[model samples]
Target: MVDHMIILLRSISAFVILLIITRFLGKQTLSNMNFHEFVTAVILGAIAANFAFNEKMQVIHLLISLAVFTFTSYLLSIIIVKNRKFRMWTEGTPTILIEGGKILEDNLKKNHLTLDTLNQMLRQKDIFDYSEIEYALLEINGKISVMKKKEYHNVTLKDLKKGSKDLGNFPIELIMDGQLLEGNLKVNNIPPEWVMDKLTARGKQLDDVFYAVKGSNGQLYIDFYNDKITHPIDIE
Candidate 1:
């Protein structure tokens, strides 16, 4: 086996190099690898794969190459962020694949996309047909995001003139795994005698219960192990 210390140092160096390189490449590089970036990434991965264990492939060379790639990506991002024209040239804006129920065939073909794929995505999003879509945009990362006209949107309680109901507060567990929770019982203003009396009246032993959670509505749910069944009980 290789020395654990050397392996750890190499791993740490690899991680640092990856972090620097990733930051330099900008968010777009990780989001969707464009054609040229994709090929460059494949080559980089191939080169880095062998460097992990090869005795000749020094860590310094790995760091240098990674730094160079990272710097190139960082500089490009700065230019793209500062210059609108350059940004538009380097990173194309989102295209409206379908607008007002009409599909833009030209943009679709340009992006090497098909109506079948678009329809598949639409259906996955619960949209039955293209007519139901008001706008469908081909985002920069090549993902299709669809928006439906307000009329076709799902209905809410407000739309039906019936407001939503309130969901009550969180439940508290007063008894769990056959153990009495003194703090919880005290916090909820219930005496220990009340719990003991309730269980005794129901002909159930305190230790017989597997778990129990209490609600603000004054209802106590008790569960027992299936193997320990065959018992008589009574409760309010």
Candidate 2:
């Protein structure tokens, strides 16, 4: 029981330390963490786990190790930010895989990307036909950025030479889980009476709504708690 208590306490301590280090490293460490940053995080996690659960390992020694690794990574981040050449060396430049609707086989070979993989990536970007791509770049983080040809690109009102009007902000949630969000309604200038009228028209009360939002198109999108769809297609 004592041993378990020790492990629990150590685990909590390690978690707190790691959380502080992560916050110090900033949000980018999680959001846009490159290859090196990712490896550093993995290593730190392993070290923390070892000291937390493994009684054989000295807690002080592991803490010191974690501190050193985190400090080194933080210092390297600073250097990378200040030095352009260092940044390029650490995080390789984006490679152009496709140009002018033509596949660069040499570049693909260099990146070790197979035609099948390329096609899969293209399909992810909603491009089934490679011929429709104007440019496709393999980013430093291994994600593919694609640009479709003018003909294949999505058309907007501006493309049709139509004057653009303010379409309000994106859907603001006025209600969620049958709870009214008066603050959101006030911020969005949505009156409660307008919401009630809409709900009444659909024969739904506020309590019946599981989720509700005021869309940018000036429409109320409401999902009911009892709502059911027989054939739910999986898009993802």
Residue range 33-122, candidate 2, lDDT tens digits = 787799889999999899789999998899889999999999999987766568879998888899878999999999999999999988
Give me the runs in candidate 1 sitting further than 4 Å from their true place.
1-12, 23-44, 53-58, 155-236
Model 1 error, position 37 (Å): 6.6
RMSD, one per candidate, in order = 20.1, 15.3
Clashes of each: 0, 0
Q: Which window of 10 residues has the lowest lDDT sum in candidate 2?
A: 163-172
Q: What's the lDDT of the predicted structure labeled candidate 2?
A: 0.84
Judging by lDDT against the true structure, name the best candidate: 2
